[model samples]
Target: MNDIVPLFGFTTTPLELVSFVLSVITVALNIRQTHWAWLFSILASGLYALVFAQSRLYGDAGLQLVFIAVSVWGWYQWLRGGTAHGELQISRLSGAGWAKSALMWLAGFGILSIFLKSYTDTDVPYMDGFLTAGSLLGQLLLSRKKLENWHVWILVDILYVSLYMYKHLMLTAILYALFVIMAAMGLRAWNNSAAVPAAVAGS
Candidate 1:
């Protein structure tokens, strides 16, 4: 694990470095609305599971496994699940969609937080559950091509950076900070794309 992997003047394990790079690549690809992002996400999540396990963050470790499954689903949806030509088109969530997503987030947080507190040795159950719930909804939105996914990620990633720092995972923390920036770029890109259609229809 102690192979030479440079991370901003600090050295880290190969697993951490690889996961960090994969996460960066995945989010960068996502910002471009590329289906290939899921492929990178699968690898990143697997490596991160191991990393979190080593850190004794069992909830986070489990979440990474869930991320692997979500990545596969996201890949299929992005490539073939759509109303036209089997390729998904980007779109915004309606008011009803927002309401449902909010409900899902709240329910997931409550359930996961309780489970973590009761079943795991995790020190920050609520915060971990918060990130997990937000990420689940964000992944669902991304798979469905909802433009709001980036917004969800922006909120989640900001908190995640601090969370990882608390756990002393500096390399991964930096990676999440980059995720924050990429998510912002993604939101802007999706907004511009969504606006183009509206402007054309208006004209």
Candidate 2:
């Protein structure tokens, strides 16, 4: 871990720098609705797993592994999970879907937080669990090309920024802040894409 030294004259590790660059590229591609984002996600998540592990954020480290798997699944889903011909399309979650998502997030948060608090020496189990649960939901939604995935990310990223800051992960906190902005841009881009068909038909 200490093999790679200072970055940009900051005390940042190589793992953190690599993860940050990959994450930024991943989100940028995601905002453009490109399938290549998953590749970056896989790499970024792996590095982040190490970063979180070193920070003693066990939950988040495990979450990064899950993110890697989810990234692979998302890659296939985006390529072949759409209506007719394997083309993914932007869609909104229904009320029922929202309720289900909420239930899942809450349940995950509760269960994971308890486990973390009981089994780990981590000081921020609740916050870690919260972000992990939300990230899982956001990943699922993104895989399905749901428009509201960006909304999930927006909320999750804000909380993550705060948590990372509290943990003295300034670079990670900044990354999460960038995530918020990218998520908003993604929301707008998907919203416009979703409306294109309607506008054309109405015209």
Candidate 3:
């Protein structure tokens, strides 16, 4: 097994490297309920957008554009969507939330897989669609301040790490490994917020 980082794809370039690094920090801080996550997301998604396009992962690439729009919206939600006391408190997804997100993921993957298999000559079409569709679900959940988003990310990131490894994108694989850690930390941090509520705990 090779251990060295592969210098292939968009992640190997300088801006992508910085963008990738910033993405990790942004995600980590976001889980900790910090507002800097959006900044890193804006940087990282811009680079990944190119990466996915080059790899013919059009669905994933397109998702990054949506991410850009959502990031701005998320930034605003994080800043002003809190209760009167302030601080973005984490919460679990409601039943409707689960139903809707699950339906969306299923529908997206089914449709995109058929489209890619028919119109595109890409390998691993199912995996591509699965990751892309699942990411949309995860990102939306995160934007809604749902703690379960971290759980979805944990599952998705695990799959991503393996997929990137197989594609020889070692750096991105490692980044996903870090995301797994960050997601765990996020779960704990959000649970803490739930116990005492970050906005009211100090006072």
Candidate 4:
């Protein structure tokens, strides 16, 4: 749809460009370990919900709404989550932490995919659920300042790129491509940030 200039259906629409701009800022804030990232992500997702709905990507559209809720929780978590610190700091997830994350993602993916396949006319149920569940975990991890969140984002972003292409949303596809690269950069930034102690920084 991005390749064409139609009256609707991503043709002449500026949503993709808007989404890209918001996503870029979101990734940048994420790289700085700023809780503000979730704010931008939420706004981007709100726009994406409309785009996906127009494209009949029902599950993906619904997922964007979930992102809105997750962003709120993530924002609250980042602001005053740990004790009386008043700010959270980047950190690594422990072994059990990774395990719990894995289990939740797997279970959510399986159940959500099955439900979507049965309830909606979506073709790639697994892909939708996979991206959704991974994003949920990544967002939660990011909310807690866990560096491993980037890994989840990288994986989902790659898959999402292909999915957008499959839907003929070239702009969305390109945006996900950028997301993958930014996730990689965020990994480096967050990892380096983890090396410093939260008690010392002027966050």
Candidate 5:
């Protein structure tokens, strides 16, 4: 799977191509609020772990492992993490919730960056850590059916495009670019979905 092959006039490994496809499917299912998205996320993250490790992106490689574990928890959350332990509902973050998320992102970035820098030879430890932290926050928010998860994803995906390009992973870079657009769509869709409850309660 590591063998490089020409694709669309560029080059990528079969593993990357497969990862790219699975990730796209995962995001699409997520936008629809489908619980099955987590399964695809697990598969994609596992494959991408290998892809990132080969490039020596230690932070990202480790992150993919975390993603796999998180995806499992996320799957259960989507099914039962709501009022009265019923199906989860789409909801916005409170002001305090947003503050907590920001703090968590900063803390995770600081810790992961220091660890990666001290223990790994990856050339872009800081960037890797920053994005890895953001991705984790985004995934957590997503698992809880928080509306702001899409916002987190949009920022992370935009930055990831540049990072992947720097690492010469052109296909994965393109995937992140597509993720930016899809994240925006998800934000809008979830916003509308969230409003329905409010509108109904008001009515």
Candidate 6:
């Protein structure tokens, strides 16, 4: 799986190619608010753990393991995390929620960067930790069907493209670039979904 092969005039490992395909499908399902996205996320994250490990991106490798666990919980959340244990619905974060999320991101970045720098040989510890933290927040918000999840994803995905490029993971970089676009579309779709309830209530 680690063997490099030519693909689309570029080079990538079979692991990465498979991960890229699964990840794209996962995001497409997510944009459509389908719970099946979490199932694909588990598959993608498992493969990506190996891909990032090979690149010595310990933060990302560790993050993929976390993603797998989170995907499972997220799957459950989407099924029964709403009012009265109903299916989760698209919603916006409150002002206090936004503030809390920001604090959590910063705190996670601090702890992760310190751990990665002290315990790993990764060359981009700070960058990796920052994105890893943001990704966790984004994933949490997404699990709950929060509108702000897309905002977090857009920023994190943009930065991930550059980080993957610097690490010479061209295929993964391209995947993150695509994530940015997909996240934006998700934002619009979720926003519209959230509004429908309000429109119906006012009718």
The weakest ten consecutive residues by lDDT in model 2 span: 1-10
lDDT of model number 3 = 0.79
Give one digit per residue, the lDDT tens place, for model 5 in 1-203: 99989989889999999999999999999999999999999999999999999999989999999999999999999898877877888988999999999999999999999999999999998999999999999999999999999999999999999999999999999999999999999999998888787448447
Worst 10 residues of 5 by lDDT: 194-203
Q: How far off is residue 126 in model 1, in Å?
A: 0.9
lDDT for each residue of candidate 3 in 1-203, tens digit (9 for 90 to 100) = 12233364433555446657878888877877777788788878988888667657777777889898888877877777778735556788889988888899899899878877888877778988888889888887787688888888998999999887777566777889999988988888887787885548768
Please provide TM-scores, in order, for all candidate models, with all chains considered together: 0.91, 0.93, 0.86, 0.89, 0.96, 0.96
Alpha-carbon local distance difference test for all models: 0.87, 0.90, 0.79, 0.83, 0.95, 0.94
**lDDT for 106 (candidate 4):** 97
Candidate 6: stretches off by over 4 Å = 198-203
Residue 141 local lDDT, model 5:
95
Q: 1-203, model 1: which lDDT tens digit per residue? A: 74757667866798898888898999888888888999999999999999998876777788889988988988988888876657777898899999999999999999999999999888899998888899888988998889999989999999999998888888888888988999999999888877776448447
The TM-score measured for candidate 3 stands at 0.86
The TM-score obtained by model 6 is 0.96
Candidate 4 — what's its lDDT? 0.83
Q: TM-score of predicted model 2?
A: 0.93
Better of 2 and 3 by lDDT: 2
Clashes of each: 0, 0, 0, 0, 0, 0
Q: What does the lDDT read for residue 72 in candidate 4?
A: 92
